[model samples]
Target chain A: MGQQALCYDGTWKGLLSLIFDVYAYKYSISAIVTENNAIQSLLFTSALIHVVTEDIKSARVTKGIITSVGKKGYLELYHVFLSEKEGRELLILRTVQYYLGVKEQASKNYAHADVLEVKKIVKSVSRERHRMKAFIRFQLLKDGVYFAIAEPDFNVLPLISKHFKDRYADQKWIIYDVKRKYGLFYDGGEVQEIEFGTENRLDQKSISLAGHESEILYSTLWNQYFKSVNIRERKNLKLHIQHVPKRYWKYLNEKIEMGG
Target chain B: MGSRIQEKLSILADAAKYDVSCSSSGSDRKNKDKGLGNTGAGICHTYTEDGRCVSLLKILLTNHCIFDCAYCVSRRSNDVKRAAFTVQEVVDLTINFYRRNYIEGLFLSSGIFQNADFTMERLVRIAKKLRKEHNFNGYIHLKTIPGASEELIFEAGLYADRLSINLEIPTEAGLKLLAPEKNHREMIHPIKYISNRILQTKEEKKIIKSTPKFAPAGQSTQMIIGAAKESDLQIVHAAQYFYTHYKMKRVYYSGYVPISNDLRLPAIGTEVPLVRENRLYQTDWLLRFYGFEADEIVNDMNPLLDLDIDPKLSWALRNMDRFPVDVNRAPYEMILRIPGVGVRSAKKILAARNFEKLRLEHLQKLGIAMNKAKYFISCHGYIQRYADQQSERIKHFILSGSSSKYVKAVSTQLNLF
Candidate 1:
């Protein structure tokens, strides 16, 4: 039983500083905390240190590891940190710190268990990235802005912007990841990040123009098309929901008006 | 006619809605200048309640017909709302819908407005206007009127990305009894004619190097199953003939939906045999992609597809002597016979195995669902004996699992919408 190790803040720079501390102390760090813990570790001793603020030199050194090992290395360390896999994270951190000391030896194909583990984490992240592409649903907002909300397991918001930008070039849209509290907004051109506090919870009734004349016509025409195209004999309700999950039914124009 | 057009479209599009091959695929034509829209691989704007993609502006040119085809809602004696679109109206609709990004292009069919030639000419006029007047480069699928004049059929081939003529029933006798106006020769003649035109166009393109694309997405046809007494074997035979002789892109089998208590058609209460439709599609894939022939899969003696098992697994079960193909050493085609290995998964196995000798562990890592594939394939030196030993029992086991999987997929899909 011992007190949990603490770091200054929960930024990328703070995590790197913790890695540096582990290397300097020659002792594997269990965890880094921004706050105190009630339970203490009995078998292993813990060290608490205020995280050093990121400077030009430290930033340059961390950027070098990322640039050399590529984005996969950085993401592996991030996922392990998020999962709070103490032993795995410590091993990865120590390996990265050692590799940084010998930059030429830090090839992506390096024969190390830590490197392979990082590849697994990278694979998982990429799978999550593809899932977000498939599952993200866009709701047409009142001001003609199509907004979508997702809560992907990983930070995939930045990766999916290119797809929407190319596909919906004529429209303005926003895809927000509520879990990460971040969003990507496309304003008929390039995509940009809209900060967390800038937007509020979307009001469904306010966004819908059902009461307006033109909106009613558009909805009626769409429903006409929807109803016309449905094959009653082949009404496999199961297959319909698979392609378009009911979770997205709230935002779909045809579904919303018809109460499908 | 405009009011009539709306009424018929609602009825005919509702009828044509079940045909899943409304896809505008296989041709890659972009709008050259400031044309209304471009055609890419099947751009689905939305999915209907049945989860089918709605990409094409699927509609009939005219639903008024002289023929009394029992399976069709637009049959002459059905007493349904009748309508026909003017050439200009179809052109306007295509342009407007394309501009709005609501559809990729038009899938135009007719129900014999006057005769085959007359109806075919009207369809040709619509395509001509869309291409010549508007310079529209989007996908156009024109249903060839079976007995249309050769000249009119040729004109349709010039403008359409794909041309189709439905073999509404599987057997000649069925066509004779149910649809007296539609004979075997009438239906097969246009398919043969279009196939020859397509081949001739390809030859012309080779010689002059500037012939226009002729049915560039290739000719596809539909067969209405369960409307006749003909077995799956007969349907597969006709499909094979179309594929080999006509060089068809696809033969879509639509399960019959009995609309009325017509004596010529089946009872209305019976289900459309969706499971049979699913099995046919799987077998169709085998024919196209897996180098399987209709005769090899099933024959006249083995007329009906086993309702319980998928066509592929049924084929594998019958030929159990070809079981336990060595995954590590067998050729890609041989590995394809293993029930669970899809075309994509088989290709993945081939690619990944080249990097290393694949064991059960390696196959698992390569994303092969071992439970299904393991029964049919051997990894390294290990072969699964259970599937071969209790082949009948294994067939039932696998089929039940597949049925449940489909059920779950359907449930999950329903929950989504």
Candidate 2:
């Protein structure tokens, strides 16, 4: 056989199971591809999809990676997983391979190429998460559930849930990641991960409900306050764009002019 | 018809914009059973196009003042529309703004409407209603009126997280020249009282867990720069005194934005001293984070910070015998003093070098700004290019191309040890 390709579902657990398959069959794999990846295999290479996602095997692999590289490294691994970066699954597997022979924290040792690659991805994902926390603007809904939407470059909804849960514990709220098509809903008591699968594509106008008239009024007042506080003499749009980039302006109430 | 909340917000927020203290940080207040918001490690909701953080619902209780400070936009002599928010109005606005997550909390200041106590009492009542009645646990920063009664200031601290009294001008002589109605003593009295109470409450809390926190975020003050004739040395000295004695959290420098044609202040349409303001902030950071003293930053000999170079680099150039700090063997303090080596990177160096010797590449990997730190630091297998040269030559090499951009020529004298 020429170079062999192992194809699996594009999930962390699936990737872990593929790693188990490599060791189990003594398979000298040439490349690993996920189901959604668009990269084509070389001609005349045997490619097979590993059907089952073994839970026990994935758990063992996760524990081993965590024990080798600390909790922060493990979290970085997860963040890179959520990043949906191209060739990320294979990169993560390679990073784990580097950790196999080392005992001390390899994450801090940036000399390792695998660790450096993972660190760069982790930093970018963390920045996207922080930007989400700063930019999410909740508009009051008619049912008293404050609703906000974001289309982050990375999957940051899982990261920002805890912060919003703590700060807005007394109120009912919903934060929907429009790009991911899923959301987090927090009642007065607990928060639940929600998904509206294969249904209506909820756009901004569709969700800006008419149930509460004060939503428009409050947003108008906020825009007014935002405009008045800015000193006309020290107008620095370049610096402002550096902090709150144009990519986030669609979600910000203050960025939009009122009565338009 | 009565003025809408939108109109009042516009007027009062515009009036309060010049105060320059928009921070909603340093307080960790948790929401009770029915509060609207909680503050944990302050969050900036948004940044205005001017790049200032809109962290709080910063507004004045009223814009009607008795004193005519020449530099103030809200001075009694200025022809601006006057507006006032009632006690209930202020409380309602804070709660509504906070619920929508538009702010971390409230920063409430007033323009001394009736008297010091009268204005301060209303400020205290608003805080009381937010904490006791509304059960709101968001961060609150109250601007204590100068010459306000001790009792009112104490009560205000009970509910607010931070209390501030602006020393608008740095020196007494400067204050007398422009803002004659204001004096240094009136501002310093409330600060002293608040500082003593903060210390006493800390001791009580150690003994009794239920002693209650008093201004738990501490107090901060502001001074307007370039509005009066005070040297950078004078400003740094006054800031050091406030930080050392009162334990002030911050001393913000507002680069006086010219408002009107007054002989006492800069003429209207004169450019704000933004570059000077930025240099002062860098100097302040050196004092707070980098373990540099006020005199080390600016003394009688060097009264002003070099406009082209940063304060830390200037200090390092003046004291060149301290250069070439070994990244591996240097203590945390010495590493911090090196140019472009921040607190985070210094700690990282200490941590990573324990595993292996740090080379120049290792320092770069740890995210040190090598371009500036290269002349001041030495790592394993690393050689400083200008180590054998005099400090004047080194400074010249760094500023060769940029010297044309600055109005003042580069200093050529080499201070030898």
Q: In terms of TM-score, which candidate is strongest? A: 2
Please, what are the lDDT tens digits per residue for candidate 1 over residues B12-118?
67655655577787887666554444565466655777777777888887778888888888788887776666788778767655543456689998888768898
The list of candidate 2 runs beyond 4 A from truth reads: A1-9, A12-32, A38-46, A49-69, A197-201, B1-3, B400-417
**What is the DockQ of the complex in model 2?**
0.59
Q: For model 2, how does the per-residue alpha-carbon lDDT over B215-328 read when each residue is reduced to its tens digit? A: 989999999988898989999999999999999999999988899789877778776676678889999999999999999989999998877788998999889888789988
**Candidate 2 chain A worst ten-residue window by lDDT:** A38-47
TM-score of 2: 0.92
Q: Give residue B357's lDDT in candidate 2 (0 to 100).
A: 83
> Tens digits of per-residue lDDT for model 1 on A5-69?
54545555666766665555665455655433313443222446555756653466477668766
DockQ of each: 0.20, 0.59
Q: lDDT of each model, Cα atoms only?
A: 0.70, 0.83
TM, every model? 0.73, 0.92
